[model samples]
Each structure stands twice: as C-alpha cells, then as structure tokens.
Target: MSDEEYKKVFSKNLLHFLEINGKNQADLCKYIGVSSATVSDWCNGKKMPRMDKIQSICNWLHIEKSDLLESQSADSASYYLNEDARDMAQFLFENPEYKVLFDASRKVKPEDIQFVKEMIDRMSNQNG
Candidate 1:
C-alpha cells in the first residue's frame, strides 16, 4: 500500500480500537508513555509512532503486533489469521519444508524490519 493509504488505515483503526476499549488520547498517552499530542498526531495521521513505541503499544493494548496491521478490527477473524502467520513462522522452525525459507528470510534489512514492525504496530492500534 502507499504510505498515505497505510497512514489513513492506521489512524482509523487506532481510533476505533481505542474507542472500543473506552480509551482516549490522554489515556493512551499515559499507557504508552507518550504525550497526548503524540497520540493525537498518531490518531490524526499527522505522524506515526516509532518502532520502539510499538512494543509498548502492544503491551498496553494486549494484542499481537501483526494482528493490528492486517485486520481492521481486533474482533475480526482476519486478526487471528495475522497472529497465525507469526505462529506458523514459529512452527516452521521445526517444519522441514519451510525451515530453509525461514532461515534465509530471517536476515531482514534493518530498515525493512523497522518499517514492518511499525506497520504492525500502526495496524493493531488502528483496529483497537
């Protein structure tokens, strides 16, 4: 997806998830250890969260990062499918057919890894 499309999706999803959880920007700021302004930026799609903050968000929201990215809502079956992808990757560590692929793909470039991690965080928060 284009960066703008991704941003819009992320922002919408985050707002929805927070609303479902009875949260607001102030609450999220406290939970994620960021300023309310920062949360607002994220919610408004004015800015995105950094990679380090993604884990804190996941922890605060009690969700897998991947679930936030691929599905629009935490309640969707597609959310679980995203989780399943991670599980499958872990499972593939022991599966002969995928072991080589897993090993080779493990070496992700730093920038790509950060981008993906951020996307997952953004997606999950959006769905929340």
Candidate 2:
C-alpha cells in the first residue's frame, strides 16, 4: 500500500484499539505525555504521530509499534502460510462449527472424507 493508505489504515486501527482498550482522547494524551490536541489530531487522522510518539503510543496501548503501523513484519503467520494453507486456515478460523465437523469426521463417518475433500476443492476453485 502507499504511505498515505498505510497511514489511514494505521490511524483507524489505532483509534479502534484505543477505544477497545477503554481509552478516551484525554486518557491517551496523559498516557503518551502529549497534548490533548495532539491526541485529538491523531484520533481524527489529521496528523500522524512522530516516530517517538508512535513508539510511546504502542507502549501505552500494549501493542508493538509494527502492529500499530500494520507493517508486514507484524503478520508473520500470513507470511508463513502458503496459498492453500492460508485459504484453509482462514476458512476454518472463521467457522467454529467446522471444528466440530472436522473432529466428528475423523472419528466416524466416511462422509467426513468427502466433506474435507469438498472444502479443499471449493478453496482451490475460489482461488483460481
């Protein structure tokens, strides 16, 4: 992504993380030792934090700086997963019901073999 795109994504992610962490702008300002206005600018995406402030913000939010920035290094799992494994992992991770389906398939039904085969086929087709 372009730098501007990355910045926008980072800003949105930061705002979401802060909100989830129960931090308001005033709390973030105090935690990062920045002016309330500066925190406001960041929350609104009016300005990007400086490197030092970014580090401080990451520390305050209990996230790594790379994760806040959405840097490639922050997503090691994605990097390691091959195309097929990535697709399978994404599908299974999103559907908790599939875990039961998979476990039950292994213990008793020959139909479970067909179900897994169908899942792999569907993923391959979607990717193609």
- All candidates' lDDT scores? 0.61, 0.64
Location of the lowest summed lDDT over 10 successive residues in candidate 2 = 100-109
Off by over 4 Å in 1: 71-75, 78-128
User: Which tens-of-lDDT digit does each residue in 6-107 have in candidate 2?
Assistant: 777777878776764557888887787889888877777677888998888877666677767774445454421245544544465577545433332112
Q: Cα deviation in Å at residue 9, candidate 1?
A: 1.4
What would the per-residue lDDT of candidate 1 be over residues 7-59, giving only the tens digit for each residue? Answer: 67767777766754456889888878788888888888777787667667766
Please tell me which predicted candidate would have the highest lDDT against the true structure: 2
Clashes per prediction? 8, 0
Listed in order, each prediction's TM-score against the native is: 0.53, 0.51
Clash pairs (backbone) in predicted model 1: 13-126, 13-127, 14-125, 14-126, 17-128, 18-128, 68-123, 68-124
